[model samples]
Target: MAPRAGGLYVGKMVRFTSVGLRYAPPAGSSDPGMGQDVLSDLSFELPAGSFHWLLGPSGAGKSSLLKLMQLAQRPSRGEMEVLGVITSRARRGELPALRRRIGVVFQDFRLLPHLSAFDNIALPLRIAGRAELALRADVTEMLRWVGLEPKAESLPPELSGGEQQRIAIARAVVMRPALLLADEPTGNLDAVQSRRVLSLLQEMHRMGTTVVVATHSESLVNAYPGPALRLADGRLER
Candidate 1:
């Protein structure tokens, strides 16, 4: 079915005008008062359902850009509209709702070691107060898609690094969020494993999920076919 004009189109193309971001330094750093200026005057619009890859060297602020999109942190300057909502001025009380619409995958694969694969995948739905019965079906389906059905009862420690990362991906998309941000998702995997992971991400994108993958891996960039946003010195060049 065609997406309606006014209603939400998950993973649909969205536009962003000028966007900028900065971060306050931690309590004590070399330059105590010098906060980090990550993204500067970033202006770009990511269409809904578009698959975008963020390429940059370390500390280039690619993750920071994704954080802004996820609404986990507000931009210090300019404005951003993701999933059709203005983000710079978004209220704190409104964050939970906005956050629930995003799915994030960290470079470290931040899965709860204590939770089973099933439980981990269901965490988002559970946090959003979805009914238990409904969560089970969705989580199960997501796990199956990621080829983790057999590991559904396993914990993070019991799985290989690749396996763990897939589980993290499963959890991220189990809720079918409109936006998916993956930070160095293939950083720890081998060539074959990375391809597997990227393939899964591609499948999600084809399913109408907006995907943004941030990575410094050139091999990954070559392997995955998609639009790219390159970051350098805290600015998006493309």
Candidate 2:
């Protein structure tokens, strides 16, 4: 079933109007191809507390769009609003706070190899200056939610791909972000693992976190259909 929004808000969480992105050349360089558009004239909105699929084939500029949404790259042209902050118009100093309200899961399962599962999940809270005792409780609850409480002291290398991904997901949401993004989250998992990961994501959406998932698997989409933003050649075709 397609995940439904929890009515957490009455408006959009993301808005892109005529957005374009071009990788700029290095200083003092004038190569003709240096500034070509990677994404052009894109417009879309992700409603607050809703779930969305970012659908497209490779080289379709999906990653570029994700980058823009994550505040990792500002659009070269047009307005881009994420979590209510229009990057082009916002001050440079305001981004970090906004970033904290967002969470991301990567396909590669970027958990720190040396850190214990508990420590990896606890890292973000530690960085945020969360009290050690309070964060311990939070991390414990996350491990329980992912059914990994027994594996807490294990390192990433000692766990299965699905477990590692779960740890990554746990880490991503440790702060309980308002917006959550997953880029090919099930790309590295088997059918069972993939379904488990998808379930966790859907649960997050149900809890009122605005979620966007970018993936190439049609079967996965068919399995859990949702509203989507389709892209082709860097444009929002739907």
Candidate 3:
């Protein structure tokens, strides 16, 4: 599968084959063996332009899996193909380009307090060297899409948790990356706001972006009725 213009692939956008991850023991421990595998033998394929929910309890390696998908961390062992690029085989210089094609919504709304809502959304485009004139329109439209148009000039500190989360989302998708990975995106919002955020992600999926949301909220997962990948003890359950 080759990555297309939008970061999507002709077939699977993400493919994990016997993937495994194990972190080293803190600094120095008498442990000779490798730390326990955080995730083991995890195999799955996320179809391009498809939507999925990653379900699991806390410490179930849900975050770890999402990290691998976002190219934040490579698997300790096994193969991963994201956006049709073999992660392990990709050169260091090629990573930034590969990453630009994916969008990620972190569990903790990682917003830049110094920047306004508009600037936050415009960051990606700015990094890509978009013109200032075009950035205003594109960022404003993204803020509007996330229902934060009025907060464009407001700093992250001035917004509520929900607002910050939405801003993070807008920023993530501002460039229309081909793949979107959200980690517990609704953790800070009430039921209504949660649904609204979910709907936004769904809309992105409809627009040809492959979306994967990691969450332990059963209610949230149940509402969508989409395919879900459940994890427990570092293994995936279909």
lDDT of 3 by residue, 1-238 (tens): 4736633456789999999998878786878655889999998999888999999999899999999999998888999999888996688788888788789998688998899998889998998889999889889889889988988999999998888988999999998888999999999898887888888899999998999999999988778889999999899986
Q: How do all the candidates rank in terms of TM-score, highest first?
A: 3, 2, 1
Error of 2 at 212 (Å): 0.3
- Count of backbone clashes for each model? 7, 0, 0
Q: Which residue pairs in model 2 clash with each other?
A: none
In model 3, state the lDDT of residue 79: 92
Per-residue error (Å), model 1, residue 49:
0.8
CA error at residue 133 for candidate 2, angstroms: 0.8
For each candidate in turn, the TM-score is: 0.91, 0.92, 0.94
lDDT of 1: 0.82
lDDT of all predictions: 0.82, 0.89, 0.89
Tens digits of per-residue lDDT, candidate 1, 1-238, equal: 2253333364434455566776787676778536867788888877777899998999888888878887778888887777666766667897788788788998789999899989999999999999998888898898888888999999999999899999999888877787888999989888777888899888889987888999998877776667899999888785
- Give per-residue CA lDDT, model 2, range 1-238, as digits (tens): 1222442344678888999999998899978877889899998888888999999998888888888888888899999988767776899899887777788899998899989999999988988889999999999999999999999999999999999999999998989887899989999999999999999999999998999999989999999999998888888885
**Scored by Cα lDDT, where does model 3 land?**
0.89
